[model samples]
Target: MIFTRKRQPLNKLTIAHAAYTLQKEVKWLGITLNPTLSPNLHLRMVKTKTNNTIKQLTQIIQPTFGLCQREARILIVGVMMTKILHGSIIWYTNKNRNTVRKKLTGRLFQAVQLSTGMMKQPPLPCLELYGGIRDITKQNIRLAHNYLHTKLAALIDDGHRTLIWKDLTVPQPIHPSPLNNLIEKNTLLQQHFTRTETLSPFPVPPWCHRGSWKENKSGLALRNLELTWRAPKG
Candidate 1:
């Protein structure tokens, strides 16, 4: 299959003497990735799965001849929700993604109410009040931050540095930094470094200018500091 993105060259190219057909989206590693690299398709898939799970749990957690409120709550939260939010950290980024996540969260909230013999169609705030669940969006943000922190820590501890870190030593005048994508996605990492002028497990490179901690009091100021991994060749 040919993977042609929007507004790109639509040249019909094929290999091994076979023609290829263009597809709008493709399933990769159990995630549906689209031409725009958005997670909308994956969100819909998750929504369906969550709905089915909720329905099945609801039947088993009925008030009579079923699990009690506490038992149902534990099972639904620990098992169903966990299954639904497996890879949320990677895809749950923008407002649209949050909206999709809210749909699942709302369903979970309703399921909690149903299991507890409460009103099924209660308001959002009422659900939080009774269900005692944190804001789903905030939870996703915290999960994303934790995932990023783990990745950074592992990169720092690796015996052999990645190619991107290795590129920091090379004086490439024409190319941009390979770490730009990482810095863009994980803003928390940038904020952490900005507050503390320390990149542990890696020494301050010659390219990175070490400014006094007092020089930038406001953590909001995003200064373009030249960070490097190699020492200056004096």
Candidate 2:
């Protein structure tokens, strides 16, 4: 952990969720109404839904932290939060270091709740899976027989999605955010995450990391998603 995001500690006075917004971006190509098609944004609405799971993250983030209307947002079109999940390798910071450590602690390990599933999307002709995301668009593989789909399959089979630990009684692989911890991930909690914005190296199941080209078929990507804690249905 080399980077540490800077922030002033929580004094109860600075714990303001109203000052923030959960804006994360999704990069994709879009197909419009008729002949015209281009890249578009699939924004997720954070507005409290009837489903208990959807509100889980927003409830904590909305009142406890001081985030803005993003509670109604699912995705922010062009923004992303990869650094918070996958972590940084080259230039690190305090914001990132603390975030990294808080995320792996054993105590909160049991508290994390995740859902694994998938949504319908299209296919990409070829995906340029960037490695060691920093500043370089480095190339990894040039598939001959199969392209992105095959690569996504390998990621899923290898366990990119299938790790859920709602009970925390068992050891589970960590990924998805909006995770609850006895201890806070950000020591100096702020309205928004100030640490390095890093992406997981295939952290979310291939499906979670899916795009126009390939998708994770196991429905394990649910681990990266969050839903409100509802009492089990009768």
Candidate 3:
């Protein structure tokens, strides 16, 4: 697909004796892209797919039988939300816009309502709180920031890092690019840090032998206890 801001006629081309035509939109890597790069169509498609999945889930997540509330919540959040927010880092922006926010939150809340067996009378925030789900906008922003953090941390060349930092930090009027918005939203970007440089508790060399499970039972028990304590209480 040709990406351009102006409306124009499609151009026909022949390459390797094969005819090709310009497409208004195309799917690449499971993301739908148009010439204008607007995310509306892609998001619509995601919403449709999520709706279908929710319908299927409703069959098994009955109020009287099938998956329990906890399992339903897990499925909705872990599977349904993960699918809905797939590729969000690329197309998600203007998250606070009323139209976009309402549409996405409405669809997500439907899934939450299904999982929690809640009535529509409840407010979105209450549904989210009871369902143990984060706001879709917040989740998208966090994902974008985490992606930026990972990319920045993985850069090996100082010059390349500087170039990227400059690009991300560039000022844009009115509507800012997603990366720039992420940089602005996250204070973590103010400092540069590398994952490789971070200190680890287990600093022993790879060649060093570790103790057997029998010898590490106390540590294992402590770790398990910590995890159990940290887990959400139903």
Which candidate has the highest lDDT of all? 1
RMSD of 2: 23.2
TM agreement with the true structure for every prediction: 0.24, 0.16, 0.24
RMSD of each: 19.8, 23.2, 20.9
**Pairs with steric clashes in candidate 3:** none
Ranking by TM-score: 1, 3, 2
Better of 1 and 2 by lDDT: 1
Question: For model 2, how does the per-residue alpha-carbon lDDT over 127-152 read when each residue is reduced to its tens digit?
Answer: 33534443321111112113333443
lDDT of 2 at 170: 35
1 versus 3: better lDDT goes to: 1
lDDT for predicted candidate 2 compared with the true structure: 0.23
| Candidate 1 residue-wise lDDT, 11-111, digit = tens | 44343333434356543223344667545665665657655766666565454332343443345444334333433432444445545444444444444
Error of 3 at 181 (Å): 41
Model 1 lDDT, residue 114, Cα = 41
Of the two candidates 2 and 3, the one with more favorable lDDT, higher being better, is: 3
Kindly provide the TM-score of model 2 when superposed on the true structure, using C-alpha atoms. 0.16
* Clashes per candidate, residues 3 or more apart or on different chains: 1, 43, 0
Q: How should the candidates be ordered by lDDT, best one leading?
A: 1, 3, 2
